[model samples]
Target: MPFPIIRLDYMQISIEKLSHAYGSVEVLNDINLTFEPGEIAVIIGPSGCGKSTLLRLMGGLEEPSKGAAYIAGQAPEGSLNPLTYIFQDFALLPWRTVAGNISLVLEDHKLSKQQSKAIIDDVLARTNLSEFHDALPHQLSGGMKQRVAIARALAVSPAFLLMDEPLSALDSQTRELLMDDLVALWSREAFSACYVTHNLAEAVRLGHKVIVLSRRPGKVREVVEISIPLNERRERAAELEEVQQQLWHMMREEALAADRELADV
Candidate 1:
């Protein structure tokens, strides 16, 4: 029997010969890629490979020096609300309660009290932070703080989510736990995400597809599709390890070349 056909609306994002520079130092060069809607694409590379810079360009935090970045069809007009970012540092306002932080962006939308409250409640439940709505940032652990960051980003209901090493700061145990939570959230929310990370294991475990970037003046080296399902694995350690090794092999030469270049500089 033939397999059922799945229709994807394909909210296509494209970058064409994009390049960015800070003064004389160039960060990205001739970078071209596309992201399809409802897909989780992770960017991985050695440190300072412009992985985060590319994400920032996608998020509209920074403009490319050359070429173009497009979402859907045309470039966004005026202020774009289609993209939101989750930072590595849980940039939660210390003074605001968990719910307050999540609701912060909603205020600008002129949402009614009832409408805002509904979204807050729903996202809180989805992120498993319903019980800590009134808690302060300091009261939560590292993993919980990142959860608040994720919840806050989701509260905006964006078309695309940009995450920059959101799990890098936590301890191993906490990172693993949050990784599971992240996979669960992605499965349920189905938001298109472009996550930047140096962790190959995290990339393999969480991404539907992974893109590896080259050294300084970063460009795409490869794009890999992950075949395993998150829920299918009873234990992720062995699977993650195997994929991690494969990813490392793919990146080994680039990483070493990058190191040598940096040392010479």
Candidate 2:
């Protein structure tokens, strides 16, 4: 029998006047926003705008210099990690088998062997990695390695996924395929996440609410809402295209200026 989809609680992530700085350099400033459970909040901005830093703050991986990034409400029962990260570089151990890579995360939770195996099996099946269970990271393509990283994230039963350019490393074709996989996975078991990406298409395709940030000392410049349902986004691609274009227009000038500033530095 398949492992049943666990009912998750109503968790809400809120960023309240959140500011952060590295030495004297301020990266993010007073970034306040809120996203509820079952929604994907995509953060997009020019490079050096601290999108990843905001994600780290959300996940409590770093302490902000000022303000707060906090979650309200309980994580689902049996969640080993309430907040999990899926990084751009599929950070799997080079030597571990697919199953072993997943098992590593569970080890710290002290789950019984049976529980660990069950979690691993369930996530692998959900991610369509069942047949590749014993494969090493090197044996898989770029997309498949990412799929394993995703499956590993799922094994922890995350309340919120802090994805930092999770698909940016893949070629265009592979990235497209992975986006489809993500939408399909979301359809099965609704999950919440703060996804950081520089790609506007990715922001439009995956984000329920796309939060656009300004250049350095990044602040919430705009929050563009997509009313289309996730399952219908493909058929409604034209509409999403317009929204994507709108986002591009909003970021274009700042992006250019941000680029020039980097060039000078």
Candidate 3:
């Protein structure tokens, strides 16, 4: 019988000298990054570069093997709302209806039935999943299921949203469509995010700043600021492509180096 205990506000997440290792082998080393409120920082790197591990650290799900992750405006783990994570797979419970899946996050919180319904309804509407409230995961298209997952995350009003290739599972066309939806949603909600992916186009299309990590045992190779205004985002398609190309070149260089190292081994 507890009441909701937190307010929804932007959170500042910063990582400093963060490193993680599994036994003697390392996955991420001296990684440093920061995500400001109202911005998306997309992280791109080769496989095994610990992009997901970095997100886990940022979400406070795992302790850093070195350095630390910091979150401003922190709250207790059991608070009504905490950090939310969206995975590449739409992790909705198959047994639950769309509405039921969204309601799962509200369970730990103390809220009147009316209030919970209101939150769920609003989120469904926001994610364009209002009509699918009665749908089951098995019945939904990949895109629709992802929207339901997004709505569930939004229902909790997380301070920061951590995503790990959340759109990777979708086909190319669906991925592109959802990317547009995400940019629009993020524009309206201003939620801070750390999105990890291997897709540079997705990174440039959605990120305010893109962080490129070197090969395995990731380290920050470069930080690129994308200044394309939202209004001009699509209109100025050339600019976005230019930025993407720049990121591609950087990544290409890193990829060659990784190949050379592998050959030596």
Best by the lDDT measure: 2
lDDT per residue as tens, model 2, 1-265: 4432333466678888889999888899999888778989999999989999999898988999999977778888888898999999999999999999999999998888999999999999999999999999999999999999999999998988899999999999999999999999888888998899999989999999999999998999999989898889988999999999999999998899898884321
lDDT of 1 by residue, 176-232 (tens): 898888888777767778999999878888888889998887888888887777655
- Which regions in candidate 1 have their CA more than 4 angstroms from the true location? 1-10, 73-80, 233-240, 260-265
Ranked by lDDT, top first: 2, 3, 1
Model 3 compared with the native: what TM-score?
0.90
lDDT (tens digit, per residue) of candidate 3 on 121-166: 9999999888888988999989888889889988888777889899
Model 1, position 193, has a per-residue lDDT of 85
How does each model score on lDDT? 0.83, 0.91, 0.84
What TM-score would candidate 2 get against the native? 0.95
TM-score of model 1 relative to the true fold? 0.89
TM-score of each candidate? 0.89, 0.95, 0.90
| Candidate 1 global lDDT | 0.83
